[model samples]
Target: MTAKVALVTGATQGLGLALVEGLAARMSTEDTVYLTGRDAGRVAQAVEALPAGGARVRGEVLDVAGPHEAGRLAERLAERHGGVDIVFGNAVMRVGPEDDPREIVGAYAEVNNFGTTRLLRAFAPLLRDGGRFLVVASSFGTLNHLAPALHGRFDGLSSLDEVDKQVAVWRDAVADGSARGGDWPGFVNIPSKIGQVAAVRALAGERREADLARDILLAAVCPGMMNTPTSAMWWDVRDAPSPAQAAEVLLDLVFRPVDPAQYGGLVRDGEVLPWR
Candidate 1:
């Protein structure tokens, strides 16, 4: 019997590395897991750092966000096992230095949103009939908490929704209007308290191949602001979970009964979040 193989991207440190460890712990006797990163050295480090008695794990170098790298990974996997059984898109970029509201719109969208689109495009087809797809996202994607309370009024006017409608209502409030200094409203109240997590939701909403491809497990997990070098101020954040704990909580989902084929679209904090 051929062993099931799993590929985890950005398996260097933080949530990615922790997940690699946890998955290794759960691998069956005839299973293999591969950890991948952009750099060869980092991949080596990830392989060496595998849990003491985890599965027979190995590491490879592949930047999932790049065409060349993803292609090479596809080639290697096809040659080795014909296709992969699982893919953990557990890589992301949070806010920039000091969580600058200024960079939130562009930088975060570029890395967190579009980058994911590119990676999924590259690897979704390589998944075997029963492969799982897990994407590491943030709690920010919830979009349910965009309260009018947080985002303050612009030019002395309140209501965050108004700003959102600025493009439609005011006709160019973004270009020639009082919405100038307040470029990114996140500074005032961070309306998108859950947009990052919502990105996973959005992708699942738009395209739910992971769940549909096979009897596969598909999830979008919020690792919970764990103590990771993800951001310099991780330690300062109020009680943060350990990467190991996050990993454990994430994997525990596999056992809990949920239709992998039905709700394979999204997962939040281990539960499948609404894609509606």
Candidate 2:
């Protein structure tokens, strides 16, 4: 097998950090690893903190939402190593507590959706036939929204229309059909049709990061909920796993590709969790 270089964004903490550790544990020395984040200090710290691995670990400063970072990053790859083999688009902006549902909607679109689109556009040239591109999205982006599972309080989803409304009823436990949460529905289109259903079955938000990095065959791996600062907003789950353990899950996916259908993109409990 041909060895290659990988560039992972948001590698300072949480799930992003896991991707760093996992790749380090899995890749051989001939391969190169670049840990990135907007904060240069975090990047430097993460590089110093990496565990012993066959791959060489370096740090870079990158911002997923801003312009030029992607193109500039690609240029760096070209300068130092000639090309980049993998691009893990994991940089994300955090949301603060707010009542406005629209704010949450806008945040996800700009940060999660548009950010990925931008990076892909800038780095399209760097990715060769066998290069990999992974986006660390949430179940929120999928057809099901994983809304009912654990997104009860995520305001961005509260005002969605159509299909999302149907889900709210079952989740909110309405009394006397009075609609405990609201009179209107937040609509999102997941499981609305055959194609959507297929996508739901195929949505591998987190697992792809650790999988095979080839030309266009990108993969993802979900870190599930972890005990990092990212989970500061949600309080229901107790003592989520550490970034190190989460990294192990991703490493498993890299060394062994778990069928997306079987894993549902969120690998946990030594197996992939089934999407409802």
Candidate 3:
């Protein structure tokens, strides 16, 4: 049997762990799913707790927020498996209401935007034909939240470099207090989320012509408000679906035949959101 490989980042807890569980349950003995986290002990525990039967579960130490971690993992996976079938950019940084919005933009950019972009840059080439790359993102990732000019600027970007440049522009505005008066969104999370989605769009556009023949798919997916520990920190999730439930939804996209409609879009509950 040809071995199938999947990688889920930040899989030690919450939604990431649930995605790992969902993937493991669907894969056969010949397949493998790598569950990664920053801490070795937690990664091991998460792998051990998975019920036996589906895919072979393995633990890996990974921190997407770290400078060189994503690139290293891509290299290691390429050397060992030649390529990967699924790549989940599930790692994230949570911001609480009390945290100063301006003060946290830099941190959020590092993890939420740059980290995810780095993952795309590294793992995109390693995605096998018909493979999928999906980022666990937010519905707030739409460009409609920005001022018309800003919205147009982001929507017009054709490369990841342009997205990075725009994010730097926002960061500079925040540092100088211009963001307060400028038409920027007050919350740091909005722009960070937008940057993530925009990067996905940019990369997808870059590979569109080539990827069509290969049947590869890539998108930024919103798992909705799941009743996970991370979400409970920021909002009330009493009625939200459990992480496992959300994972099932994500896995549907992961396993389904590629849909041209969803490619490079901000997907939520099986629909591509309008950018405007």
Name the top TM-score candidate.
3
Error of 2 at 82 (Å): 3.4
TM agreement with the true structure for every prediction: 0.71, 0.64, 0.95
**Residue-level lDDT tens digits of model 3 in 5-26:** 9999878888899989999899
For this target, which candidate reaches the highest lDDT against the unseen true structure?
3
Q: Where in model 2 is the C-alpha error above 4 Å?
A: 1-3, 99-108, 128-130, 146-216, 257-276
Superposition TM-score, candidate 2 onto the true structure: 0.64
Worst ten in a row by lDDT for model 1: 151-160
Cα RMSD (angstroms) for every candidate in the order listed: 7.2, 8.5, 1.4
Candidate 2, residue 24: how far the Cα is off, in Å: 1.6
lDDT of 1: 0.57
After aligning candidate 1 to the native by TM-score, how far in Å is the CA of 201 from where it should be?
A: 4.9
- Per-residue lDDT, model 1, residue 219, is 57
Q: Identify the superior model by TM-score, candidate 1 or candidate 3.
A: 3
